[model samples]
Target: MRALVLAGGAGTRLRPITSTSAKQLVPVANKPILFYGLEQIRDAGVTEVGIIVGDTAADIEAAVGDGSALGISVTYLRQEAPLGLAHAVLTAADFLGDEDFVMFLGDNLIEGGIGDLVASFERDRPAAQLLLKQVPDPERFGVAVLADDGTIERLVEKPADPPSDLALVGVYLFTSAIVDAARRISPSARGELEITDAIQQLLDDGQTVRASRVEGWWLDTGKKDELLDANRIVLGTVTQRIDGDVDQDSTVTGAVVVEAGAVVTGSVLRGPAVIGADARIVDSYVGPFTSIAEGCVVTRSEVEFSVLMQGCVLTDVPRIEASLLGREVRVSRGARRPAAHRLLLGDHSDVELAEGS
Candidate 1:
């Protein structure tokens, strides 16, 4: 089986950051989110893959070039517009040929990867196998209803009143039979050819559709909050490795990994955190579940549960938590403006100022 990875969506939910970089390129644990999906596909024994790219095509192509670095030969499929998931599949018909394939969303992270899912799909050869997980917000996702035998009975895309709590988890396995379904279905009310509709058509035709409930975490890194959570989940797997310089005045504890060339002095780094290459932290507290990416600098400040992209600088900022800073961002206390709380936030960026401090 081959793989089709979708890296094309305009991650409007991530706004300010996505405005400059593709959402798939957002770093989680200092690694591009797209890279994790590609790695997962490679580990699934799928050697040939096609990536669907849209306006952010250049960035995606530049990062995953020949795909050799990731152990796969990649072909870029141009989706002129994100007509929808079914539209993406329809556009890649020629490349997918008559083989079974897996469609992966580049920004979605599933625990333990898709190796087991691929194995199961090949073993049973279902018409389509979907990854499902129980989520609190079923209305925000494509939901599924299963029959008594555990076969997919119906599918709905962001339904107003969801019938089940099981939401589609952004990973799908399909036989070549799906091509016909994609062509047979019409665009939904949202003006895109919904993949859920195609899957429902398969059920209407009596094709065997199955679902595998995810036993581990499933994260869609399309928003800031979700991105930070994904960082925490991934950071939990890190082993304590201080390849960088940590001065005697600093204390680095538990599950922290400081990359080579990073410097820490007069600071405390609480673990499940990472300091990327060339990053510097001085007289600060790098609290749990935080990631300071390459070339970032943090001094005389404290932060927790946050992610800072490459080249960010934070000095005398006091405290920051549950935040995401884009590359080349600078945050500092200004003697003239900061006592009143000033901000220059971007679209979709959420900020909560200290209460009357």
Candidate 2:
């Protein structure tokens, strides 16, 4: 089977960060979110992959290239706009071409991979198979209603009164029939062709629609808090590997990873945390669930549960927690006559300042 990965959405929810960089490229555990999906698709034994790209097409292409590095041959399909999930599938029709395939959202992180889901789909050959997870806020997602035999009976996209708690996970398996289903559906009230409508079309046409419960975590990294949560979860799985230099004045504990060329001096690194290549940590405390990307510098600062992207510099910043810093962001203590907070925040940037520190 082949794979159709959607990396095209303009992540408005992530704002400032997504304004400059693709949301799919956001790092979780110092790895791009999209990379995890690609790796899972590869692990599921599907090498022929088509990636859907939109405004951030160039960035996605630069990071993924031909996908040969990940042992998959990638074909880039450009979508004219950020239409919808069904629209993405329609855009990939040429590459998908009458073959069964899996559609995965690039910014989502699903635990345990999609190997078993692929195996099941290949065996059942359902018209469409969706991965569902029980979520408290079903209204926030495309929800499904199941029959007595566990087959998917009805699907709704962001219903005000959801029929069930089974929210659609980002991973989906489909036969070629879905192409027609997508074409048969009209755009929703939101002016986008909803995938739920396409799948509902299959059910209306007497085609089998199946669902598998997600037994593990499923994270959609579209917002700040959600991204941070994903980072924390992924960091929990890291194993200690000190490939970089940890000076005699430094102390490392727990599952910390110091990548080659990174230097830690007079600091405390408490894992599960990762200090990326060429990053320097001096006279600071790098706490758990944190990922400091390559070429970043942290001196006389204390950062915990935060994600700092490449080339960030944090100097004399007393504390930072549960934060996401974009590339080359500099946070330093200023020596001024009067103490006050200074910020040059971007659009939709959220910051909570501690008063009188």
- Give the candidate number with the greatest lDDT: 2
User: Cα lDDT of model 2 overall?
Assistant: 0.96
TM-score of model 1 relative to the true fold? 0.97
> Residue 245 in model 1: shift from native, Å?
1.2
Q: 1-357, model 1: which lDDT tens digit per residue?
A: 999999999999998899988999999999999999999999999989999999999999999999999999999999989899999999899999999999999999999989999999999999999999999999999999999999899999999999999999999999999999999999999999999999999998899999999999999998899999999999999999999999999998899999999999999999999999999999999999999999999999999999999999998989999999999999988788435667787777767777775
User: 279, model 2: CA deviation in Å?
Assistant: 0.2
Residue range with the least summed lDDT across 10 consecutive positions in model 2 = 348-357
**TM-scores for every candidate against the unseen true structure:** 0.97, 0.99
Q: Give the TM-score of candidate 2.
A: 0.99
Deviating ranges (above 4 Å) for candidate 2: none
Q: List the residue pairs that clash in candidate 1.
A: none
**For residues 1-357, could you state the per-residue lDDT of candidate 2 as single tens digits?**
999999998999998989998999999999999999999999999999999999899999999999999999999999999889999989999999999999999999999999999999999899999999999999999999999999999999999999999999999999999999999999999999899999999999999999999999999899999999999999999999999999999999999999999999999999999999999999999999999999999999999999999999999999999999999999999999787778898889888887777
Clashes per candidate (backbone, < 3 Å): 0, 0
